[model samples]
Target: MTDAAAPTPSNVVFVGAVATASVLLSAALACATPFAALAALSVIALPRPQALLAVGTAWLLNQIVGFGLLGYPADVVTLGWGLAIGGAALLAVPAADMAGRQAPVARTLAGLLGAFAAYEAALALAALALPGSAGAYAPAVVVRLFLINLATLAAALALRALAETLVHRHARAA
Candidate 1:
């Protein structure tokens, strides 16, 4: 676990990218912000404190986009769901971290799956309390959301790898 208050330059970039991507994803996917994917990436690519910060920043940006720009309802039910989603995203960081620790070779995949499971479980629990949310948990809906998260994770990982490769090549040339 890295120091919670200290953020390395790379970590700052990672968190900023995640936060910006969250807003973009919210615009493109509506309610699907890919928190699980972000959580998994954060845990796998960052120190523990940075991972938490990354996911939390993403969640906060999503909410801002949702309520501020997207005009989500201001009612209690809507607020409850928002809170639930934020809580789930926060929970996913530790879930991914714990699972990734257990799987050395396939840590990213393990983290992704662990984060997704935790994210869904948290939302399911919320659905039980909030009305009209059960539909979001339908089998087909769940599968679609899972696929979205999986794709997000794959693309993010690819981008990170590409960036690292470019940086290394540039350093070698220099």
Candidate 2:
């Protein structure tokens, strides 16, 4: 029988430290912002199902923390905002996937703009129908919200493109 090699103490310590650091870093990054964490998932080239899982997990965690630690009303607002942002992102994915084959820059930009416009239109109509304060029904708010949502959609699309690039590069290298 061959002699079994014993694990070195230094190697064990190094592995432990690395594992701990990774956990801490992941937690910190996820806590930073939903977008950043979602972008990180893209960077890692997670499959669609895995990507959705990450988004859903983060969303649920945010809901719990926002509701339990923060006030209930704030949590409700946060939940609404989270749902809106996530729904927009989800809607953009299909368009982006379809546009990925064409000229990268033009297609990506067009897809993002299209998705943003669609989401903004939906939001605008919903907001218009809501019975609330007149301030909430302001035209300026609608315009600003549209712009912000568009910017966010564009950013997410850009991140997705970058991730696809990295994935391609990795595949070529391998």
Candidate 3:
């Protein structure tokens, strides 16, 4: 048999555990901030299942933190945010996957930017769905999300690059 050379299951578990902790901690932080969970940003670079896992757990933890521990009102605005952020995860993940396959830097950047746009669109749709929450989208809120998403996209891309570099280095060393 060709000797197995890839990471073992235990390695996967270790990585997964670390990633989960990171996501959950980020989600906890998100509960206090104007930004969505940074977990949502990381999902852009992950595969679909992992993306779902990361974002879903983060969302759940965020709700627990915001509603359970902090006593944030479970109002339509809050609910709209949760749903909209989930929708944004769904909308942006595909763009991140596409970015992996895209060759040109321009195409990759476009894909990431498209993810940001998709997130905004999804958030808008969610707000519109809530009867009174649409008015909450004041200019300041819009600008803040726009800026946050910009930073999120940049961080996600940087993390992806770092992962790739590490993988490449490992391969070369092997």
Candidate 4:
């Protein structure tokens, strides 16, 4: 009879621990900053639709969790906010992907600005729909959302840069 090799205990334990840590860390970070978490979840590095869908699913799941745990309002409100924010974020993805084609600085800037505006507009519309929301609050919320979008954009850029650097390092090593 041929002998069968048993799985190593250490290997199993290591895999389990890594998986647990990854889940926990992702949940924590997503809750802290949904935008950045979603951006990180994107699979722009992969040139496959399946990868993009998987990444988007992860991002969507994270957003759901955050909305459930955080101070997000009803389902309608959450959905509206998500659609707006997500749509805006999506616009940047194409610009980012096209960055290597030509002079991308201006395009990236424009994309980010457009995204910020879209998010802000959506947020403002949502606020306006809410009962007891003051007219003056619209401006304040717009500013707040703009700032948040900026922060999200910055985080996305930094993460992308880090990912690129790691990829380049790996390529060089190979």
- What TM-score would every model get versus the actual structure? 0.93, 0.41, 0.58, 0.49
Candidate 4 residue 63 Cα shift, in angstroms, is: 4.5
Instruction: Flag regions of model 3 displaced more than 4 Å.
Output: 1-45, 75-77, 103-108, 131-140, 156-174
Number of colliding residue pairs in each model: 0, 0, 0, 0
List, residue by residue over 9-82, the lDDT tens digit for candidate 4. Answer: 54344334323433443466542332322322232333324323433454455466656655466677556656
Q: lDDT winner among the candidates?
A: 1
- Model 2 clash tally? 0
Could you give candidate 1's per-residue lDDT for residues 1-174 as a string of tens digits?
A: 346557878878888999888989988887888999999988877887888888888888888888999999989998899899999999999988887455554888888888999999999999889986757878999999999999999898889889999999999999
* Cα error of candidate 4 at position 94, Å: 9.0
* Full-model lDDT for every candidate: 0.88, 0.45, 0.56, 0.45
- lDDT at position 134, candidate 3: 47
Which residue window of length 10 is worst by lDDT in model 4? Answer: 36-45
Q: Answer with 2 or 3, whichever has the higher lDDT.
A: 3
Give the residue spans of candidate 2 off by over 4 A: 1-51, 54-86, 128-174
lDDT of 2 at 29: 35
Q: How well is each residue in 22-97 modelled by candidate 3, as lDDT tens digits?
A: 4544454553232232433433334455555555555565567667776767887778776776667566656445
Predicted structure with the largest TM-score when compared to the true one: 1
